[model samples]
Target: MKDKIILKVETAGTRVDAYLASCLKEYSRGYFQRLIDMGHVLVNSQKTASSCRLKEGDEIEIIIVNKENKIKPENIPLEIVYEDKDIIVVNKRPGLVVHPACGHPEGTLVNALAGHFKGKFVPYLVHRLDKDTSGVMVVAKNEKVKASLVKQFQNRTISKEYIAAVGGNVSENEGRIEAPLGRSHQDRRKIVVGPLAKKMAITEFKVLSRHSGYTVVAAHPITGRTHQIRSHFAFIGHPVLGDETYGGPLKIGEKSFERQFLHAHKLSFTHPSKAKKVEFSAKLPKDMAWLSKKH
Candidate 1:
């Protein structure tokens, strides 16, 4: 069996494989290159190479070979913040994967939502957070709700606030990072800011407090790029503590962190069912709270 996807190029001058990876973040650029090699990708109704540069308004069609495996419901505990007919909001704990992928097939937030809903409606993911970043996340109950929330995110109308403790004392009280982000050429899993960057990423941050050599800051990402906050801070030489991938130290003096010291403190978006604005907030976990107080 196979599934087909069609996409229209919004921006020009990007490689086909890179464009595909940007549109579907679940898959990697290498995976798309393999698909193109296998003749499963077509541009403008003709089979195209992975290095093909896309023009604005170019049509891309992909045929993905389906696997037999399906996501199974698992009895995992979830901290439900808000629930309604249209959506469900959860304060996702750190270390929990948002969905199943190649390496992680179970024990994810999606599987937990599946089990929680059980015979009820299936959960539809609208957005995602990193595995090590604990945060407030929203899930749609149906496609209609998912479309509405996704559109809000696309239009940059949704508001997201995050708190993070980064290495080094930030001199600026408030500042904005306007950098372009894309997958690293050396490491596919990592994101970096440079000339090869494909998308514009913006993050505005304000210093909450200064402690020893570290600083606690509130970050608001204007663009919903992958690892936007983490990469932006790291680009400014202030990586989030415990985020070793971005050059952050694991141990700050006597204190040690198991995961990135970042949290999605608040999120605001218009309700899909009701035409009113709504907001959700999640408290900082024990480790972060303790570290903040100790320093």
Candidate 2:
């Protein structure tokens, strides 16, 4: 099925990337602009630019191509923590793309899952973390479990927790970050907070450990906005380590690690099949594990 979204400009003086960033929570800024450049975005039913300024009363239409990439299944090993008839939980490693997309069509977890299950078992994503981020991910085996899990997420019933290595030594031991994040017009690749952005979003963070120049943090996001944790953390001037898109330089000396120092450490929700509360966790990857041990 063809996916789509319609947005009405609620406020004036907003740029195209900003407006769409507020509307398209699941898509990245670059992805949305690609849509605009490809003639998939209609300003009052006409194509527009990524930087086109918007005023109140402009209607925007966005067509989304969910079919990202055609990844073939490979016999890659998975860190499966839990599995049942309805659900399977995995510790997704960094650099493993969660789904298929045009930008990254091959070597994705979806293809591997498809191959693992083949025809007898089907796995649909209940939720997804970023490609550079690692941690616990839930996959639903059947439609009922998928629908229920999605509802739980939409209703904010599920609690998501993450761990990350930030760039600087954190001053706050514990605090909340409330930011209205929207996409950037200048870069068309980063997320920035703005007025009239969208509904309220909150992230609670605690300093798990502090080191000489870096700190490990635990993040609890009350709202699951796209790149919420990463964007909010970046706004606070402590972007995740190895996060290139969010002002991170190319990582070095961390051959044991790749991408960002982020992991989906925990997910808590109810099991749809057994009707019991369930919480799953993934151990820190080898690199982080080594670092933690050394520290």
Candidate 3:
């Protein structure tokens, strides 16, 4: 039988993960974060977030369950664009988590694909887009396709493009952000740019169009890293609209718009079989289209 522990918070505003770390001092914060991700930790009798703030007198429940996490295939819907015997391309929607990780193990795109393919779907993540970042991505059905796609990405030959609504009208029509990114020593959750950071990170952007006071820009990432676009833009003092993590400030975004106005616009890759270029595209989502054209 498993054991359960209950804790009461004496103060408010301590994050759920922080509180749990205090009670279970034996576990590392990263482990506590993993516990929060696996749904083992609950707040107020409901499944809440690791970042969730606790109020005084709030009750927290913890069950010492096994440390294994398995991805359960759930029957969920998916927006598939193109497919061959070797690979499948999906028009991933915003808020749709791509794979099972962190707090999202089930109800992910993988789960949906697993259900759609009826256990036949093999999920080979060629690349990743953030949970909130909507875009087009390809999944390989076999190892051969996976290896080819992975090589293309590693060689920086895959042609990928994105459109984003930023907080303000940028002065330059085009520019590149070259910075080294690595895990922040202070806050482990975020990536930091410094000379001590890892490999050269680069992003190229061109103003595509403007609307309703927000600038729609095309971003071509020469390198892929966690939150690269969001972080790089924010580093330049213009964060993407609606991305609170790296977003500068509320007033800054409100001055132009709301919502992370980013979209995966286009992708192109070389097919292993035909040795030809295959291209895919997704239209601008409704949130970015709510406003009329300005530029």
**Leading candidate by lDDT:** 1
Using all chains and alpha carbons, the TM-scores for the candidates as numbered come to 0.78, 0.73, 0.71
* Candidate 3 lDDT by residue in tens digits, 1-295: 3334445565678888877776555556777788778888878668878889987546676665653213356778777788878888888888887765334446888777766766565566677677778878888876688889989998989988988877666888899999988766676556667668986789999987765545678899988777788778877877888777665434443454444667787899998777899999976666665532544
- Flag clash pairs in model 2: 68-101, 68-102, 69-100, 69-101
Cα error, candidate 1, residue 153 (Å):
0.3
Could you say which candidate leads in TM-score?
Answer: 1
Report the Cα lDDT for candidate 1.
Answer: 0.85
**Relative to the unseen true structure, what is the C-alpha lDDT of residue 189 in candidate 3, on a scale of 0 to 100?**
51
In model 2, which runs have C-alpha deviations exceeding 4 angstroms?
Answer: 1-71, 249-258
Let me know the TM-score candidate 3 reaches against the reference structure.
0.71
Ranking by lDDT: 1, 2, 3
Candidate 1, residue 209: Cα displacement in angstroms equals 0.3
Residue pairs in clash, model 3: 241-259, 241-260, 242-259, 242-260
Show where candidate 1 strays beyond 4 Å: 1-69, 291-295
